[model samples]
Target chain A: MKAVEVKHLYFRYSREWILEDVSLELEDKEFLAIIGPNGGGKTTFLRILLGFLKPTKGEVKIYNKPPNKASYLIGYVPQYTTFSTDIPIVVEDIVLQGRLRKGKFFYTKEDKKIAYEKMEILGILHLKDKKIKNLSGGERQKVLIARALSVEPKILIMDEPTSAIDIKGQNEILNLIESLELTRIVVSHDVKILFRKVDKIAYINKRAIIHEAPQLNIPKDRHFCEVELIDFLKGEECGI
Target chain B: MWDLINTSIYAGILLSIAIGIIGSLIVVNKATSITGSIAHGSFGGIGIGLYLGVSVIVSTLFFTILLAIVLGVVSLYFQDRKDSLIGVIWALGMSVGIIFLNLTSGYQADALSYLFGNILLVGDSDLKFMAITDLVLIFSIVFLYNRFLAMSYDIEFLRLRGINVSLLYFYFLILTSITIVMSVRAIGIILILALFTIPPLIAEKFTKKFYQTIILSSIIAFIFIASGILISYYYDLSPTPIIVLIASFGLFLSMLKRS
Candidate 1:
């Protein structure tokens, strides 16, 4: 079954078209990385896919259903900076929030077990009792990822999962995400790490162009520098 | 003296429940000024009630709920200018109340009580009303605890999970209005924000969980209210200011400890 299918999708904000004639499809458990320049509607496209926003034209289906109806099957890891650490919430409490369903007032024992199990998978069980404010940036990111995974979603979407962390932390997070076997959609700027990990790449600039990773001849061991990335994108722009 | 003490205790416990539950939400959501507007704006309803020969509490409840919905809608749409808009409503309600009271024929002998609270004058009927409000507040919290926690922490995430964020927010404002209006007779509208803010601020320092914060703040508020009543009794002063002063002192000490 196809995990995501976007057909002739068009989106606009105010007057300008943010996404134009965008069409794409992904099979189940396929890893897709979306890369683009800043304000190129990358985030907006993701928001539409998550049902946070609707496309101006055409249709988007997740597993043959509308995005909002399939929302429970989709796990989302938002940008870590979006959260405020001022609130007094513990790590376990945050992870348990993923288990929330409509009209369920209290967390059951099974929910607690799943929260702990997800934390254990992320190697954050030791930090379960600690408050969110006390964690480092990398640790907090992991906590967020664990929170997302606690829902046991069919598709995992992350928006710039490694934006603010150090390079080492970024590599660690990328490796962790690479290990997951779900249908993964990651929006990122770290092309070097992302290109190596993803099955396919979608270059978005007011539209989308999909390329299989093997066709690009990107070096396996060499680090992708900015100039090289720009040259590659420039080459692709020329229909090479 | 004993009768006064008994009344004070009952009112204190009841007010603490509202203060603790609603206060935590207000502080976490950063809705202090919105709640303040609701408290002051209900004065207009008090004036209307007096003029129309209706029950003041019922009228004030209606007015504040209306004001809460208005503020909720305004803030949801015009995020940047909400504070200024709330200030306008605050002044408008107080002014309208004064004008309506002026238009009434006889002197408003008990008008000052709503402005500053006269807990000493609380009757059996007031206590009964307070008890009912407390029960409603407690029941709402228990039934909606998880959703409230999610909403307070991250509303967008809750929305993504298919929860009705806007409807829940409206219900939240309604509950807040009811809590604020109920406390006006005991804590006074002018001094009620302190009761809603201070204990939570102090409790947050000692607790790392949401429920713990609510429970601890309620306990702290009860202690402050009890001690304030004792001090007022000894000095023959009003209990409202005394209670607020003790809470502010606790806030100060908490800040000092942090520093």
Candidate 2:
């Protein structure tokens, strides 16, 4: 089943055309990366898909329903820096935000168990009591990912998951998302950030350029703009 | 100084804490200035209540919510530009209040207590109302703490997860209105705006997270009220302004130190 669908979507933020005639779709369990330069409407595209942005023209559907209605089925971990970490929240509480899909503040026993299980999976169960401000960047990202996963949505979308983190944190997050079982669509300028894990790359500068199963055996010399190709990367690790 | 610190001063101290806690929450939630507008606009409710010969507290409770929700919804509807619109409502509300105060027969200046708060003058009934409002604020936050946090930190993420962020946003406005209505006594109509703003402004100097900001600001508010109560009682000054000014001073000092 296709988890995300956008057709002729056009969005303008106060006179700036962010997404123009952008249409794309992803089947269930597909890992897609949206690569673009800064301000190329990557965030805007994510917002439109999440129904946070109203397109001036076109339609967006997630899980067979309209974006807004179908949003509950979508999990999101927006850029971690968007929120201040100095909040006194614990990892457990942060993760619980993911369970928002369940639609209640007070969690049931089963909910509590599930939250803890997610925490354990993220390897931060022991940090449940620590304040968010005290955590390292990588740990914070993990906690955020755990929170997004708490809803157990079929489709997970992240915006710039590896942008500001150190190399180790970047690798951890890249590996973590790669290991996840859900369908994933991540946006990043760092092409190689998700290349190791993602099955395909949708090169988006102004428009999306799709590349199928870019494994090591693929003959990249055959297609794509020369300048668009990176210095060196092969197979699933596409132009790294 | 020792003799000035009496029983009433002690009561002032406790109320001051309440001020800071509420102030901090207001700042973190970006409801400070809006709450200020609501506090000022509430005079309209106070005026209508007085004119109608109804219980002022009841009127305030009802009107604040209606008005605050209106303010919240208006801002949210306008995509959070209700600040300018709220300014219009504030001025209009005050104008209406002044007109009603003048036209009403019994008490023209009797509404002075609401204009500039008298913390030392907070009666038992006012205290009771404050207590209830405090409890509600605490309860709502405790119950929906995670929801509120998620909404505050990452509203889009919450919306994506289908958390109904809009409803929660309104829920915050409702709680803010109720808090404003309750604390109308200590902060007065004029200085209540400060009580909703200054302490949090100061607290943010020391704390990063929303809850810490609330705690620190509450502590500061408590101190200011306690000191203001003593100073007001001895020097015969208006306690609300004094307390709010103290908080302002604290905020200034904190900012200075950070700078």
Candidate 3:
């Protein structure tokens, strides 16, 4: 069974259509990069897969179950813009929230150990005691990644993981995400950063088209630019 | 003097405990405006209690909780219009209270006491009610600390974790409403927001964690409450205004030091 399966998904916000006839499937442990322009329904597609929204038409299945039922197995790193740094929360406490269970008032020793283990894996264990607001953008991203991983999810999804950081921070985040041993799905606007790392690229406008990276015949030494890549994808859609 | 001192002390302890726990949630969740509305809107309940010959505290508790839930539901359904909705509720509540107070038989000599608290008027029953409120606030905070913290930071993330975010938020507002109403007897409806916000602001400066902020803010609240009571006793003034002034001064000093 595929790790994720979507067939003829359509989403509309009131009178306008946001996503139409979008469909894709992912194998176990595959890395899929979703690239699109701003407001091209990239984030909306991820939200649908995360069960934050339901498709207007068609169905989505994760590991043979609906997205909502399989949500526990899916680790999600929402866009950093959604986080509020004004709250007085430490790194450990924020990460420990991922382990929250119904009727559990206190964080058990096992829960703490798991949180620390995830932080250690993400190389952020040293920053566990630090305030979330005091961390740099890159450090905060890593902490968020550690928090997501603390759930022990089989699939990991990140929305715009590198959008708010500097170039070096972006590269570092992408490299870190590439090294993780889970089925990874990321939505990004920059295609160049993902070109060499992702197994497949799904170019999404209002629709989505999946292209296996190895079959594209793009030279490894060639530097890909965002404008060119966007045009290239648009041309592909036009079959020119 | 001895009776007055005892009353102030009891009121101080209860106020400090509620402000410490619920105050942190208020500041973190940024619910001060909604809390302010609840505090002011509670006057309507007091007016109803007076008109119906019911206990003011009990009636106010019911009224405040109902108002808080209404605000919560409105904000949940209409996110952008919450501020305007709160404004309408804020005005309507005070207006309703005035209408009810005017309709009640005879003149209420102590009606102004509810608007600006008169700690000297606090009887033994009021103290008992305040004590019970403090217990409920403390128990709820202790039992649901993790969930509360999670909800405050990110309600969406908490919901995605399979936690019932709406139910948690409703209970949070209920606790906040209780805190606001209970404090009204000591600090008055007009000045209670100072106590709810100032200590948490100062505590946020001193502590690195949410729980630490709660503990530190409670201690700060105690100091202000105690000092306010003593100052009012020495000068023969209203304790609510004095307490709010002290808290405001502390906040000013903290800001000066930060710059």
Residue-level lDDT for A224 in candidate 3:
64
Tens-digit lDDT string for candidate 1 (A182-223): 999999877755455677788788988777765776776766
The fnat of each candidate, in order, is 0.54, 0.63, 0.67
List the candidates ranked by DockQ, beginning with the highest.
Answer: 3, 1, 2
- Which candidate, 1 or 2, has the higher DockQ? 1
Task: Itemize residue pairs with steric clashes in candidate 3.
Answer: none
Candidate 1 matches the true fold with a TM-score of 0.95
For model 3, residues A17-115, the per-residue Cα lDDT tens digits are 899898888998889998888899998899988888999999999888898888788888888878688788899998998898767778889999999
Candidates' DockQ values? 0.66, 0.42, 0.74
Winner of 2 and 3 under DockQ: 3
Steric collisions counted per model: 0, 10, 0
What does candidate 2's lDDT look like per residue over B67-93, in tens digits? 777787777788566668888877877
Cα distance off (Å), candidate 3, residue B92: 1.6
Worst 10 residues of 1 chain B by lDDT: B153-162
The interface RMSD values of the models, given in order, are: 1.2, 3.3, 1.1
**What is the model-wide C-alpha lDDT for candidate 1?**
0.86
Q: CA lDDT of each candidate?
A: 0.86, 0.73, 0.85
Listed per model, the TM-scores of chain A against the true chain A are 0.94, 0.86, 0.94
User: Per-prediction RMSD in angstroms?
Assistant: 1.9, 5.0, 1.8
